[model samples]
Target chain A: MKADIIVDTKGLACPMPIVKARKAITAMKTGQVMEVLSTDKGSLNDFRAWVSQTKNELIAHEEQNGEYRFWVRKL
Target chain B: MDEKSQKTTIVLFSGDYDKAMAAFIIANGAAAYEHEVTMFFTFWGLNTLRKEAAVRTKKGFLERIFGAMMPRGAEKLGLSKLNMAGMGPQMIKHVIRKHKALPLPQLIELAREQGVKLVACTMTMDLLGLQQEELLDGLEYGGVAAYLGDASDGKVNLFI
Candidate 1:
C-alpha cells in the first residue's frame, strides 16, 4: 500500500518497464517498497516472473482499465 | 536464486538490425534483473560491434573487400526481412525513435553500463579480416570455447 519509489512506465514497450523497475529496485534498501505503474500489457507477467526470479516479493498487483499497478518489496 | 540461475549467455549470429536490437534488449533486460549477461558476437553478428569509421589497416585484397562489403557498425546493418533495399531499416529506426525506445547504439551503451560482457569472436574477426581496432574497444576476444565456458554454466543459453 505504501511505497518509497514510484516508477511510471506508461506507454513503454516490453523490457523497458521491467528495466525501469529493476533500476528502481536496485537503488532501494532492503525491505523498501516500490510502486510501478505500467501501461504495457506484457509487463503484468514480466514483472511477476522477474520478481520471482530475483527473489523479490510482489506484495500485490491490480489492473484498472488498461493500466496496471504493482507493489514490490525488496527482500 | 543461485548464481547460475542468474546467468544468461547469448550467441549473436545475425547481421540484421532488428535481430540485433532484439538481442540487446533481452541482454539489457537480463542484466537489469542483476543477471550475469554475456553476448558472444560471431559470424555476421560481428558487424553489430564494428566501428563506424573506417580504420587504417593493411590487409590482403580479399580481406579489404570483405571489410568494405559488410556494414561498418550497428547503424548500417540492414534488416533480415522487408529490407526494401535499405528503406526498411530507416522506417524501423523512425518508429523506434517515435516510441522513445533506445536505439541499437544506445542499447549497446546501456548494456556496457550495466556491465554486460561483450565478447568478439576471434575466429570470426580473423575470417572477416576485422582488426581489433576496427571494432568497438573494451571487448573480450575469444572463440567458441570461451563462449561454451560461459554458456555451460549459464541458466539461459541462446544461439541467435
Candidate 2:
C-alpha cells in the first residue's frame, strides 16, 4: 500500500507508538495515507481502537517478522 | 467528535514514578483520541508536579520535615516496588531509554502540548504547605469539587 508518510515507532512500547501515530496522522492532510511501522505487539489492538475512536480510517494492517505495519488514512 | 462528551479524567494519588508514568501515558493516549483530558494531582501525587529546584519558603518544623522526606520532583521519584535504595528507578530509567520510550517528564510535556489539563489539588497543597512556586509551570489549581466537576461528565474516570 502507498502512503504519504511513514512513521517508524519500532522499539517503542504501548501508547508511545499510538501517540506517535496520532501525531503523524494529524499532521497529514485528509485522505493522505500514513504507514506506521511498530514492533510493539499491542499495536494490533491499539491501532484498531485508535481508528475507531478517532476520525481516521485504518485501510490495511499486517504483521511481518514480529513487526506490525498499519496503513491509516486521515479523515 | 463531540468534545464535551469525549472527556477523560484521572485522579493521580500515587507518588511512584512508574505509576505516574502510566497515568501520563494513558492521559496522552486519551488526548490523542481527541478526548479532553484532565489529571488531578493530590497528596503524594502532587510530588510529580514539583520542580527540580527547591523553592525557599517559610514552614513549620513538621511541614519542613515532610518536604525533606518526600521526593523533590518527578525526576527524583522512586519506584514503588523493589526500589533497593533508588537503584530500581535508575534501572527502570535505563530500560526506558533503551526502548526509546519517552520518559516521564517528556510524556508530561507531550501531554501538555496535546492540551491535557494538569490540575493541582489546592487542599493538598495547603495541607502539605507547598507553595505555588514549588511546582512546575502551566497548571490549574482546584479542590475536590473541581475534580468532580470535570470527572462527572467524563466517560473515562480513573484513580491511579
The top-ranked prediction according to lDDT is 1
DockQ of 2: 0.74
Residue B94: error of model 1 in Å?
1.6
Clashing pairs in 2: none
Per-candidate iRMSD: 1.5, 1.4
Report the alpha-carbon TM-score of model 1 versus the true structure: 0.95
TM-score of each: 0.95, 0.95
List model 2 lDDT by residue over B1-160, tens digit each: 4644499999999999999999999999998888999999999999999998889998999888888888888889999998899999999999999987889999989899889999999998888888788998989999989999989889999999
lDDT measured at residue B2 in model 1 versus the true structure, 0 to 100:
43
Q: Tell me the spans in candidate 2 whose CA falls farther than 4 Å from its real position.
A: B1-5
Tens digit of per-residue lDDT, candidate 1, span B54-136? 99999999999999999999999999999999999999999998887888998899899888999999988999999999999
The runs of at least 3 residues in candidate 1 whose Cα sits more than 4 Å from the true structure, single-residue gaps closed, are B1-5
